[model samples]
Target: MTRDHSKTFYFGSRFFPLPQRQAVWAVYAACRVGDDIVDEPGGGPVVLSDWWARVQSALTGRVAFSQAGPHPVDLALGWAAGQFPIPVSAFQELYLGLRMDLEGQVYRDMDDLELYCRRVAGVVGFMIAPICGYSGGDRTLEYALRLGQAMQLTNILRDVGEDLARGRLYLPESLLNEYGVTPAMLEAAEVTPEYCALMRHLTALARTWYAEGRAGIPQLQGSGRLAVTAAARAYEGILDALERNGYDNFRRRASVSGTRKLLMLPQAWWEMKLG
Candidate 1:
């Protein structure tokens, strides 16, 4: 599933030992399933509600489907939750975040956008921290949250055009107003100076979070540290790609190449060894 949906993450996961890699795959797959439910054509409130119900059941150890038994995602996640200290409430927050998408939610400012990121992506970091062997406290969790936010911000910037085509805008309204950018401008796929400036601002914000996220890597133990670090570098590389394209995210999706991803592994290993 990771290979099909997210090659960058799949590549990063290879740094982990077998058991940790499998656990990350399960967690990632479960989240991917939830995301697909909203992104899929013909999906709506009924479908999302049903998915939430199934997720709740799965988290409680109940079978989500009678005929099919538990969903494979649910089964994998269920096993992962048992092995790690993943909280049920974190998944609940994730569902709420997905529900926001279904409701056509818009952000008023960075705070509102950050809240959404935290629910949808930050909680994912929290869920995986235990498996990575980080058992510190709020400080450690803060790193995970920052990493998740950085990645989500990168995703938002990369998918601006695609999201606008779907009639959804992840960009905050205030930022748009400040930059004199309008919904019509984005919807029309305009790549004006204003749009570039707006994207540049967002890209800068993402880099800050990425730095903070990377700072927390030293806190992690075992080979998982290398995996997480490599994952961070890979995701951050998307920002570099965006800059290289002159912030023309509407017309060009930014991504790190496979060769670059492979190169990050040795650097990640060096960082892990040093720490």
Candidate 2:
């Protein structure tokens, strides 16, 4: 399958200042590529396993199989790490989370859910926090972790139907049982009121977490703050879209259009610039 780089316009979006844009793109591209290896049609566990191995090699500056030629994601990640004081362990965390996707792991409870979120989203926050100059106490970092968890939870909630179709379930099992929702019900694309109520509750929880995430933005440094803010807002916007659609994600995939996104870019810029 052909890898499409066309959707990467955000990498060059004017919302990001020049200095950090390229480095951010490198990290985003790396993550997107790794994710696509699992997401592509006909891509299987063997393919994902191979990609992870490549990612590990690239992270250590030994890119033997990356299509990025001499400039592998790991090398780019290393450069980004140098430019920012991002923790190396964050990359490990992301890798661990991505592995879950390969195995179609399910969450037994909130604790399991938290671990998955840490792997996928928390590490992203860890990588980004230092770049935004948010270095302080463990409390500040704790906020970042919660911020990441909020985003990941939103994603899991929004993609519930899709993930189920893919033979994966991210909702906590306890919550499912509490609502009388079964994996089979989810797999069958049944949208009962209970399911809707559960999704509404989860989405509300995510919104609150994202609101908490917003508190850390002001603590960030200059342009980096704007970049992170835009990302956070843009992702939250997806949740809003889901709400507007009446949470019928099973029938329609929720998305913010390019025009809306374009408007958001300027609005976000003004918010950060004037403030």
lDDT of 2 by residue, 67-132 (tens): 546545657766666677656577677767878887778788988998998788777777666756
106-213 in candidate 1: lDDT tens per residue? 799999899988888888888778888874688988988899989998899999888877888889999999999987788788888998999899999999998888
Candidate 1 collision pairs: none
Provide the overall lDDT of each model, using Cα atoms, as 2-decimal numbers.
0.85, 0.71
Angstrom error at residue 226, model 2: 1.7
Best by lDDT: 1
In angstroms, the error of model 2 at 152 is: 1.6
Model 1 lDDT, full chain set: 0.85
Candidate 2: 10-residue stretch with minimal lDDT: 1-10
Q: How many clashing residue pairs appear in each of the predictions shown?
A: 0, 0
Give the distance in Å from residue 179's predicted Cα in candidate 2 to where it truly belongs: 1.6
